[model samples]
Target chain A: MNNWYMLTLVGNDRTGIVAKVTRILQQNNCQLGEASMLRLGGNFTIMMMVNSELSSDDIITALQAISAELNLQVHLDEIEGRLHEHHIPNVLVTVIGADRGGIIAQVTEKLFNVGFDILNLDSDVAGTDERAIYIMRIEGQALDGIESIEAALQPLKADGIDISVQAIETLIA
Target chain B: MAIHPILTYPNQQLKQVSQPVDNFDHNLRAFIDELQETMHDGPGAVGIAAPQIGHAIRLVIVDVSNKKKIKHHGHLVLVNPEIVEWQGLAVGREGCLSVPDFTGNVVRAERIKLNAFDAYGEPLSFEMEGYEARALQHEIDHLDGLLFLDRLVSRRNDLFERKKR
Candidate 1:
């Protein structure tokens, strides 16, 4: 395979969000390798794996244009060499407790600052009125493994959030 | 005498709780051998339980050397195992051979003090930590007819159909 790319899009839920994003990638000759799409609350989430012989610059420019037009947040990163041979180090992060507005942004921002690439994430508001519970399993990849992550997430302790991390092996790019 | 085919989900056989080894007969030797063989045969496979091979016996063979993370932890073969005590809770993503095509977050005990009969029928007690504990617990759960799917603490948005390579 040629170079591999991971691109993600998240924004206000709208019709044709996927088609518009994919259409741009297809124009840039990016091969869709993997994809996951979901609508949570009022937002649409799209994560895709793409392959192209072109430089990261070419793909990023195309994605940036679409993000501007659609008002979506986007991220793109390239995988290379020996690191490409190893399976993406997917980590499962589970957070269970009461629901709140800034959970995704807060958790994901932590992951992003430390170079974690989210693969699949799904959350639901569970339980009844007196005791409400929110359970979410976010699948992500961090090639550096648990040591780096453990240090990066020390602040989460203040929030009384339970954290568990497991390194996963899934597909060589 | 050889690696046995893993009885995947919907096979019905994988869901049945295994019978306890009453006498440690010749058949028990063969069952343990096959479980060890099968674990070595798969690419990243570490352990195999009796139910996973269509046998309903309280036995599981684990060798974590093949897994990079727990390679230094060495091999563990547990027969009629019991976790005497455990401390603290840790969540990990666990997958089983019987439950092919998916993995999920499972909260399991982080450290375990347990006892089991070894290959020579001698009682042995040990304390295991980290990923090793998770792997051992996962295999033992199979002996009780519980697949990793049963331990899925959360659900993904989609069914996540696996396409064989």
Candidate 2:
């Protein structure tokens, strides 16, 4: 029987990180599952689901050599292997404005209050240091209908933030 | 007419380029009926292609009349369809009967004028815009062995997992 684990690795961004790590996993006879590997804030992070016959400790030990060599941090936790959980987003919300504190918090708070479940969110700061612009794109499900969700977020417009809510119609063609 | 099973992704047949329909006969009529039945059977299906039903032919059916508040040409049976002209580009999230697990944002023409033959082998030319145009492009893509997954705006950000209702 295979053991499932949620594995995470973080370290300074470098090339061949994925190649080295995956090669190690392959050598250990580890079967990889869903994984997201990306650079965030100059750090290369890998979050993946792994299935192996080895225990968590064994897996960690297997990765210990590369972890020490690359000065990377590796964490592993045994997890239930539930395949394929579907979560579809019904609405897309875009928020753009001058960089300010608590924009995400306030926007998320309103969504939480209205039972909106966010599936994915991406935010980035652009423009110059003196005039930074905060742009956030959110995909989520609005449990209470688009109108109510719009109303809940309408208050944020007063702060000079440009907010747009669009319904995602998934046409099966 | 019977509803045909839709061939999902990873089905090698869905990846092959479909052949053009040269002979429009009783058999073709029967197949079109089956395709229409299959489309109607699908949940929220607005268009369907021959390849989707494991028939590798350049035939597709599109109906946007059921969609509320959208200008549509009602039911369309496009045989050997080709886009003659198109204008504007817009991105919209699309799901497919073949790809049931996910939806993704795909850039499509906002307006398109296409020429195709009808079910009765009658030549037809029409223009479509907005949602209708998007649907037509998607269906036509199947003839060329392309899915919306192929035309995704961004593979990382545009693809979305679809929730089960």
Candidate 3:
């Protein structure tokens, strides 16, 4: 919680974004905490939470060079609070079905309705346009109200989607 | 006197096989008490092994009895244990007290008949199935220096290595 700042960078998805940004932060001696970059459609977007003694103006000045060079958009904001989360069950959910509108929408909605938090989700489409296959993986906590989120997903079968949910016990021997 | 700091992975001690406990002495009982307390203190921990606390002994404590899906209803102090028979394969997601932040799919035996001694040196055998059996197998694996990463279904698709903590 010391001199924390949130940085968001968006640009074309190609190469070297990580390399360039990390180098800048290293030069300024700033530490990167939680960072996420995702390619949405065709643009690559990055969100990084950082903590450092360096002032925001100093970090922003360094990143500005990369922003202009890479034709990227950058934003910097400071945070003045602590971040913490209660430990909860982490489950792996897989959904596969014909690529169609609302596959991600419907599955995620049901998971949320059943009190499961969707932490991360990634989906892809393959096969063919006439019968594209969509595969997705979601990991998150299942709140107390969820009797069995897997059972609630049974209705998705009507949409040609097959889903499976399993508890992630990564540390268990 | 109860809860101890659960060791995280990459800690060399977690990889070593534990030796069987032969003494039913006061110290052994005291260690078992600490293990139970540690397991209870862990957030949602169903079972734990001796090595997890840096104690290289064949001791494990499991009590999934209170878990809603599969409840057994008591503490299990297994010492110097052996799995005589096992059947069925069940793949479930699992995380560890030592390795927090990531979770993966693990395939474990659905049922097992385990022979072991109690903390007081009394011989005991257990017939476990479903969730309880899975938890027992996981704890026993710790005694043999096995982590769930060793039996992952598929590292590529079965892992949630990216953690947000």
Candidate 4:
């Protein structure tokens, strides 16, 4: 049995971000399980879940070396127990209003600050419509006693965005 | 007592129409036992149909009382149940034990008047509302060799592919 890990590395977009990144993984005997790498605003963002048979620190050290060479900000964490991924709550939040410069930054900053992980997201601002629609589903281990987290996101109301939260448990039914 | 493996889709048994029970005898009882046992053995299985277990009989056992949304439906063991009438339409995403890894939105009748025989071979007719009715119709569709994927209005953006675990 091997350890499973999730790594998120983001940095300036370059030609060899993948080759440099995965070379380290290969050296550490890590199998590339699942990964998605994309370019966003001139930066390369990678999200991957991998399986390994090595100690966590060994893998972290290997990635650290590559990160320094590539000038990438890399974060590695082990996928925890059931509470961390399996039983985590999932919520869908949608915002429909005039498209402005800070819509994504504002909405996502609030979500991240409140301890929500963007699991699967698809959003399009579209052409110059009077109102641009934004919809996203955030999945994460609910922050302990999420009532206050909910309160923090309430300020989005002033931006004229509609927000709703539904537990992923309900979706299983 | 016997517990049977539920036949997931891409298996022929899940798509075959089940035959109606012509008599209340040992075979019928045997089918009922196997259906219940199989459903209990499955994860989150609320119902099982004859075609799923290779019987090909129009029989299904449903007990959604263990589920969150339709526990109010109670425990039901139906043999050759028929939907005599239906009213209105309700839409909800549905999945099946036979199709282990996929779900789709399906529109079904909201309320239904049904008639069927109980496990004891006694005749029963009743009306079902809400989620209970939805679960009932889902199982019945299996009797006619229908899968929830067949009723989906359009292709889902994400069609989950199950890998051996």
Candidate 4 lDDT tens digits, B7-27: 777887778888878898886
Which regions of candidate 4 are displaced past 4 Å?
A1-90, A109-117, A126-128, A135-153, A167-173, B68-71, B85-91, B153-165
lDDT of 3 by residue, A17-105 (tens): 88998898988888887777777658898988888787878888888888888888988899863544424456777887777787788
Using Cα atoms with residue i matched to residue i, what is each candidate's TM-score against the true structure?
0.56, 0.92, 0.71, 0.61
Model 1 lDDT, residue B113, Cα: 84
What ranking emerges by DockQ with the best candidate at the front?
Answer: 2, 3, 4, 1
The order of the candidates by TM-score, greatest first, is 2, 3, 4, 1
lDDT of 1 by residue, B68-125 (tens): 6442347777778888988877655666666665566666787898888876677878
Deviation of model 2 at B70, angstroms: 1.4
Q: Write the per-residue lDDT of candidate 2 for residues A1-173, one digit (tens) a residue.
A: 55789999999998888999999999999999888888876899999999999988999999999988887899999988666675778898888899999999999999999999998887878888999998888889998888888999999999899988888776778
How much is the lDDT of residue B43 in candidate 4? 74
Q: If ranked by lDDT, best first, what sequence of candidates would result?
A: 2, 3, 1, 4
DockQ, candidate no. 4? 0.13
Candidate 3 docks with a DockQ of: 0.26
For residue A110, model 1's alpha carbon misses the true position, in angstroms, by 11
- Candidate 3 whole-model C-alpha lDDT, 0 to 1: 0.78
**lDDT (Cα, 0-100) at A67 in candidate 3:** 84
Where's the lowest-lDDT run of ten residues in candidate 3 chain A? A80-89
Candidate 1, DockQ score (0 to 1): 0.07
Question: lDDT at A131 for candidate 3?
Answer: 76
Higher-scoring candidate on lDDT, 1 or 3: 3
User: What is candidate 1's local distance difference test score?
Assistant: 0.71
Look at candidate 4 and tell me the lDDT of residue A154. 81
